[model samples]
Target: MSIAVITGASSGMGEEFARRLIAEKDGFPGAPFDEIWLIARSEEKLTSLSEELDPKRCRVVPLDLTSADGIARLSSLLSEKAPQVGLLINSAGMGKAGAFASQSLKDVESTVTLNCTALSEVTHVVLPYMTSYGDTLPKKNGPRIINIASSAGFLPQPDFALYAATKSFVITLSRALNQEVKPHNVTVTCVCPGPCDTNFIKVSKNDPNATFTGFKAKFVTTVDKLIPASLRAAKKGRSMLVFGFGQKMLHLASKILPTNLILFFERNMK
Candidate 1:
């Protein structure tokens, strides 16, 4: 089965990835693993996209991946749908921005649940099926796993401490997993994107720091740029896909500068 399973497919990079696969045809065409699964908390939105994506080839399962029951249901679906899963995109994530001391406990908890726990659990369910399972299975490409991290994770977080820390964990874990899974014919890629124009802003609305007060939103690219880049990274066998020049600079700075100087910028970013 050439099945490519995507989570957080309702919007942003996940949605773009789905469209790219569908349009590219070879990767996700109208047949085979061409089947697309849209997972999110909103069924209405997912259903609409599924229909647009072609009902015969697309399926939607409403899920709140933050919950254990939701994760189990998704796991069950995976077992029933593609017993030999091909690609997994872990794009389900939310953002929070604020003074850590002033943020709500709920925000912190939910971020960990969806961004950290859900991503990891989905990886666990998808990995085994992605491997070469005793030959009788139809021949196809091995599984590719993409974790949506953020450029924010490259350095110490300021107001949005937990969100950055969680992303950092994803980047770290994905790289290590990539090394281990290489021998198993599996690829793990961590995509660290800088400031994209998505629900990220609305999600972080409660936090004053998210306003990006003086910055131009136009500088941020649409989710479309990320999908192709992500796939290219996967094809090249790279473990890291850090997007945008600003992000690259920050990542570089974090490495070259003294800890105190980098920490200063992180803490003082207004």
Candidate 2:
């Protein structure tokens, strides 16, 4: 059976993707997935989400990718089922906003663990399943991997140091991995979206009211808009997707301008 595995499926962009994929299954390049595996730590939320969709088609595998035990459970399930993985979306990530020195070791470790290590581990496990089918399926419709990175990855932020650095790792990894898997007809699309109105901000800042500031706030995109655009870009085999005009510009500027110049402006803007 062919399946689409989505991490962080309980909320945010991940939840949006799950709903849309089921709602418009035929529209996606790789249509007719037999099952959609929803991976997250919240069993309650995952169960509720599954009930809302086609329960028969939606399999809720509540596993915290950040934990080794959780990842082991996923790996074992994959081995047991041996289903063909048509798509994989790594959307489980977190960030704490503060000075690097001031942040607790736990928060810093969790950010790096979820954003970088877990993502890489999940991808490594699912990649074999995807690559195995690449030769038979057309490149356009072959297995796809979407990594939900952030616009913050483009530059280093003073207050959000660890988060930005980890996202940068995602961007770099996804790009190179895309090239490595291209020969196998598997495409990896890294999505770098600006701040969105989601639980992510509340968690990041540890305050409900905290959110983007200045121009960053102006370009914030919704999950409703971001997910569809990202899926479309991935289907088209694009290596990177920046959702908003502001974010697209930031991505370009990061490439053209020197790092010190960008950092100078970033420091002054705050």
Candidate 3:
């Protein structure tokens, strides 16, 4: 079956994407990409989601995108299944909660592995099938790519420095790739969401001083709000979507103000 592959599918936006696609079978408005291949590192959870979502159209592939073997295994899976990967969502990433100087080398490495290495590796391996002329994929009506970036991408977070860097990497990479594929009718939209309930805060927060304000204004955002907005931007092929009024304002501010000033507040605000 034709498909849209999404990483980090165990929970949060990843899981929501699967459910939303299944719930709305017609695909996102102007951009329609049917089927979804869910990827995550948990077998039990993937299996459960697959069953619960009525896998009539969804396929759960428990994948750890951070390893070479994982990529090899997925490449093999794609070869056999050869589902037309119409959409690729690089939603899998991790963050560390410490100043750059305080975080352990291993913590830094792991964060980079998931947030940068794995996502890029998946895109690297999968792009051939999705963009290549191979029998390995079913015919793609139109292909689209969406990377789950963060409003953190717009500025550097000194406390969460590494994580902020990774998000910036995602935002830049998505824009660069979008330029390459526009000629072939493919769309790439980077979603810079402020915050919603997600395990990221739990895993990334280790200190009492760790603060999340501007981007993750706890008072306003909810996953219920983010998912729909992202889908709408993806449908219209928006190059970048800074969700939430706060994030939109931040994006606009970045244009008029020096980045250093914008970053000053991002790293120091309440």
Candidate 4:
């Protein structure tokens, strides 16, 4: 059976991606997944989204990817079902907003565990199923992977240290894996979206001492724009997709500027 697995499917981009997949009449452009497994920590939210899906077709896997038990559950499902993975979206991510030293050790560790470790594990587990599609490419409808990174991955964020670094790891992993799987006709696309107006921003604001308020409120994008653009980019087999013209410019600048200078500019931007 052809299926799609999406993490963080309860909210934000993951939720939006679920909505898009459900609405697809002829499957995702290049990749067509008939069944979708929604993965998230919030069972209630995942259930709510499931209501919008065909009960027989969609299965909600409510498990925190950050935990070993949660990852084990997903692995078990993969082993038992052994479904052809048409699409895998690793959108599960978390971040703490403060100086590394000021944050609790647990908080710092959680960011890395969820953002980097869990994402990597899930990808490792799912790749075999996806690659089982045989040696021949299925035209544009081959296996695809979309990993949600962040614009912070492009440059070093001073206060958001752990989170940014984790995203950087995601970017690197996605790019390298894309190359490794290219011959198998499986494409991995990493989406690096700038500050999007999602639950994430509200959560970040709740961090009292956090200095994340650089962009104007109006500039913040909705998930509507980011999700589709990312899917389209992935269908085209692009290695990386960064939304927003300003963000594109910033990503370009990060490549040319000195590390110290970029950090200095980011520190004073707000």
Best by TM-score: 2
Model 3 misplaced regions, further than 4 Å:
28-35, 132-141, 206-215, 218-220, 266-270
Clashing pairs in 2: none
Cα-based TM-score, every candidate:
0.90, 0.96, 0.87, 0.93
Model 1 off-target regions past 4 Å? 27-32, 133-141, 206-211, 215-219, 267-269
| Candidate 2 C-alpha lDDT tens digits along 1-270 | 888999999999899999988865654434678899999999999999999998999999988777779889999999999988888999999999778999999898899999999999999989898999776786567788999999999998888889999999999999999999988889999999998878898888789888777757887778989998998998888999988988888999999999999999988887
lDDT of 4 at 262: 79
In model 1, residue pairs whose N, Cα or C atoms come closer than 3 Å (at least 3 residues apart or on different chains), thus clashing, are none
Model 1 poorest 10 in a row by lDDT? 133-142
| Clash count of each predicted structure | 0, 0, 0, 0
Winning model by lDDT: 2
The global Cα lDDT (0 to 1) of model 1 is 0.76
Evaluated at residue 186, the lDDT of candidate 1 is 76
- Candidate 3 local lDDT, 170-214, one digit each (tens): 999999988887765677899998766766666678544444555
Query: What ranking of all candidate models by lDDT puts the best one first?
Result: 2, 4, 1, 3
In candidate 1, how many Å is residue 29 off? 12
